[model samples]
Target: DAGVTQSPTHLIKTRGQQVTLRCSPKSGHDTVSWYQQALGQGPQFIFQYYEEEERQRGNFPDRFSGHQFPNYSSELNVNALLLGDSALYLCASSLGLAGDSYNEQFFGPGTRLTVL
Candidate 1:
């Protein structure tokens, strides 16, 4: 069973450019969620996708968007990125919304984005 995986491990970008981050969910999971963690801050939920559709969204601006494909993999996109967007982007996966605690989500190693 494969665990969640993220790309590049690290990334560097300018303030006005765009970036794309990738993720693959854990085995036997059908949902994916993205999070942004600033240094010394807890992760802020960006959004979640299930059944190939976005199910819930957080307070992030329109610049943050994502997509989930049929295979349960996902990609997060940030447009017109800002310096504040520099943070550790984490990808989490969970099973469907069953009473199972398995729905509690497991995180990826994260993609660290540095915006200068």
Candidate 2:
């Protein structure tokens, strides 16, 4: 089965410019979660999508949003991005949401976004 995959492995954007990154979940997975990993820090959950609807979210502001397609692929959209948004954006997939034993997530290499 194909594993999770992310596009643009790397990106560069200026402060205040919006960016959209894509993700394709692993085969047979239905849940997709977006995470932001700043240098030296652990991945922080941005939000999660299941069955094409956002099932759970984190402490992120309105500037951060996402969408999951019927195919189980997803996209992370950041609006009015800031310098702080520059980080490695990771996409993870699981059979279900957190707390479920079946939810052991698989992560992609991530898109390294650089905000200038």
Candidate 3:
């Protein structure tokens, strides 16, 4: 009965450091997607996982990666983080392909990361 959940509500790190954020999907949901939102910009898609495999991705670089566990939980990892990477990382889940308006993705509050 819970909605999507994310860990480490906020984080702070220096340039070049790596960070991993986590998420747990709502009950009965399977697909998980990640997005990055800058201070004043809309979220940019990171990637998505379904059945433990990455099903879709965005324009992000290879440094952005993720994993989905059997329980429908997921993790988002950023390597060699850059100052520009400082933003709110959001996790979303849906029962089916998120494109369908009927099955719109439910989002989490997001993990805020600050890069110095």
Candidate whose lDDT is highest: 1
CA lDDT scores, all candidates in order: 0.95, 0.94, 0.93
Error of 2 at 88 (Å): 0.4
Better of 1 and 3 by TM-score: 1
Model 2 regions lying over 4 Å from their true place: 97-102
Residue-level error in angstroms, candidate 3, position 54: 0.5
Candidate 2 per-residue C-alpha lDDT over 1-116 given as tens digits, one digit per residue, 9 for 90 to 100? 88999997999999889999999999989999999999999999999999999988999999999999999999999999899999999999989764736658999999999999
Query: What is the RMSD of candidate 2?
Result: 1.6
TM-score of each: 0.95, 0.94, 0.94
**How many residue pairs in model 2 have overlapping backbones?**
0
TM value for model 2: 0.94
Model 1 regions lying over 4 Å from their true place: 99-102
* Per-residue error (Å), model 2, residue 63: 0.5
Q: For residues 1-116, could you state the per-residue lDDT of candidate 3 as single tens digits?
A: 88999999999999999999999998899999999999889999889899999999999999998898989899999999999999999999988665747777899999999999
